[model samples]
Target: MHAAVVHSFDELPRYDTIDVPVARTPDEVVVDVLAAGLHPRVRSGADGTHYTSEGTLPMVPGVDGVGRTPDGGLVYFVASDDAPGTMAARALVDRRRSITLPVDTDPVAVAAAMNPGMSSWVALRRRVGFQPGGSVLVLGATGNAGQLAVQIARHLGASRVIGAGRDAQHLELVDALGADEVVSLDGDDAGDRLGRAAGDVDVVVDYLWGRPTEQAMKAVLMARTDRSRPLAWVQVGSMAGPEIALPSFLLRAANLSVLGSGQGSVTTAGIVAELPALAALVASGVLTVDALAVPLADVEHAWTRPVRPGQRLVLVP
Candidate 1:
């Protein structure tokens, strides 16, 4: 079998022949890889930067993917934190960790959307306890995950979805993806604009943390018309930066709750529980994402290419 093998954490994965994965436990099942996404987490794992990185050498470097079993059952699976992952001709996955998909589902799109899509889906459904017809503001709404967040929020019964991003064009694009309003983060008064737009928002799904997050927090604080109204701030990703100096007044002055989602914060079963519904949405065309499917042999080149906003690069094995 061939796979994207990582010999050293410092170097890029080399696509070449490697030993096939063997199931060591009774609960594990081996599935032929169809398409795997090059998510930022996967890249971080390859670079030994993700918290889950095991510091093991000579291993495959994918966290999740869509694949088919020997009996022709289609499934999406998440790899164990320490095991060789999904960027290969085959992967060994725990049966409990895999979700069966419809036969007609597009494997490439599912592979591309699941990880990024899960960031917000799990946060809204589990962590923040999203209410039906509630208003949502997505802070980094131009990114792939943010775009999906807008759509998922709408699908989950958000009455108003505000998409906020630095890219004007991408913000416009998110409007088509179910965002009721779009806010640009380019101007000096962007925070003020965000405050006004978020005045009545019930939940905020934040993908970018740092200056944008700080601005959003200030905006929320400034726009609070009713201090009694509850607001849940769910932090999913930090593409902007890792740290922020949050004012203590923001928490004290309003009914605001800050929570982080993903990995250790959300249980593995909790994340996997939402996949079936999400996969159904994607398969039924209620949710969609722009994906480029490249051959596994082209992993090196595809990995280095600059990803456009809202676009995902999927490796087809």
Candidate 2:
């Protein structure tokens, strides 16, 4: 199988050939590569910066993909925890964890959308216990995860969904993605912008954890006018940076619940269990992914480019 192999952490990946392995377990399936999602995590893995250094040398880097099995079954997978990912001519995954795809599904869109889509899906549905006719506020709304969060909220019947980002251009695009309100993180008065846009959010999904995130956390905590409930804040990623300090008083006083959500601690079985319902959502068209497709040969460039908000880069592996 042809793949982009990373030999060293600080170096670029080189195209190479490797043997494709057969599935040893009945639950595992071998797939013919089609397309895979290129996220910052891929680049981080290639560069030895992704959370941990488990991805040793001679590894293929990609988190999720959409493709066909050796048996010609179409499938899509979110490889958030499965490393040596799907950036190759072939890859293997547990059949129980795979999402069988429609015969005519677009791999580029599905592959690119899978990871971020899953982030929002699991966070909103599982972590926050999202319900119909609720409200959601997405911090870093222009980023890939944030943008999908907006769509997912609306798809799940969020009465009001707000997109909070740093730019106008991305804000407009997020609005089109189904955000009832768009707030800028780069304006003169961002807090005011957020306050004016979404009056009082029921839930907040935070991706950035630096100053922007800190402010957002503070805003929601301090706002006495917002709708009060069992307020839940799900923190998925820290694009701005890690090491955020939270106010204990606000959290305790407001009965705010801040839960850290990610794929590392989540089991493959959990993902498998959710695949069916998620696939149904995908098939229904209520949820759509925003992606940028690139050739596998150009994986290097994709790694080098600054990731655009809500832009999932799919590689034709």
Candidate 3:
């Protein structure tokens, strides 16, 4: 079998021939990889920067993908931590960890949208118990995942959705994607603009966690009309930076609760349980994303290519 092999943590993966993976458990079976997403999480694993990286060598790097089972059924599978990934001609998949997809499902679309789209879906549905009629603010609305977050928030019944990001060009498109308002985090008045637009939002899906998160957090907290109202800040990604200098008073003064939604925070079963519904939305065109599909042989080139805002890369085998 051939795969995108990560030989070194400092470099990009190369297209190389590797041994086919074998199922080790009764519930596990080998599936032919159809399409796999080149997501930021996969990049982190390939570069050995993710928290879960074990510094293993000559490894395949993919978290989830669409594949074909032995009986000619299509499925979307999540790779387990201890097994080889889905960026290959064939991958080991656990039956319990996968969901059967409709025969007519588009493999490329599912592979491209699932992982990124799942972040916000699982966060609101499982992590925070977000209710209908609530308002949401997406902190990094320009990125691929953030763009999906904007749409997902509205689809999940958000009364009003506000998108705030550093890119002016992407911010312009958020309104069309269902955001009630958009704020640009580009100039000197970015903090003020964010506060005024999103201060009273019921939920915040924050992807930028560095200086932007710090400034935005303070701005929203200070501008809230009712400080005692509960505000759920769900941290999904750290596109800007990892750490932030958080003021203690912000937590004490307002009803602000900061939590994370990701692999460790949410159970694998919980994440998988939400996938069928999210995948259905993606298939029905309710939750859509711009995808660039490339052949698996060109994994190296696609890895280096610059992806446009709100676009994702899918590697097809």
How far is 20's C-alpha from truth in model 2 (Å)? 1.9
What lDDT would each prediction earn against the true structure?
0.90, 0.76, 0.92
Off by over 4 Å in 1: none
Better of 1 and 3 by TM-score: 3
Clashing pairs in 3: none
| Model 2 stretches with alpha carbons more than 4 Å out | 79-83, 196-199, 226-228, 306-308
Model 3 Cα lDDT, one tens digit per residue, 1-317? 89999999888898999999888989999999999999999999999989888898989999999999999999999999889888999999988889999999999999999999999999999989999999999999988889899999999999999999887887888778988999999899999999999989999999999999999999999999999999999999999999999999999999999999998998899888998999998888887679999999999999999988889999998
In candidate 1, position 200 carries an lDDT of 85
User: Highest TM-score: which candidate?
Assistant: 3
Worst 10 residues of 1 by lDDT: 50-59
Q: What are the per-model C-alpha RMSD values against the true structure?
A: 1.1, 2.2, 0.7
How close to the true structure is residue 258 of candidate 1, measured as C-alpha lDDT? Answer: 90
Could you give the candidate ranking by TM-score, starting with the highest?
3, 1, 2
Compose the digit string of candidate 2's lDDT tens values, residues 188-233.
6787667666546778888887778777776666664744556778
| Deviation (Å) of 217 in candidate 3 | 0.1
Deviation of model 1 at 5, angstroms: 1.5
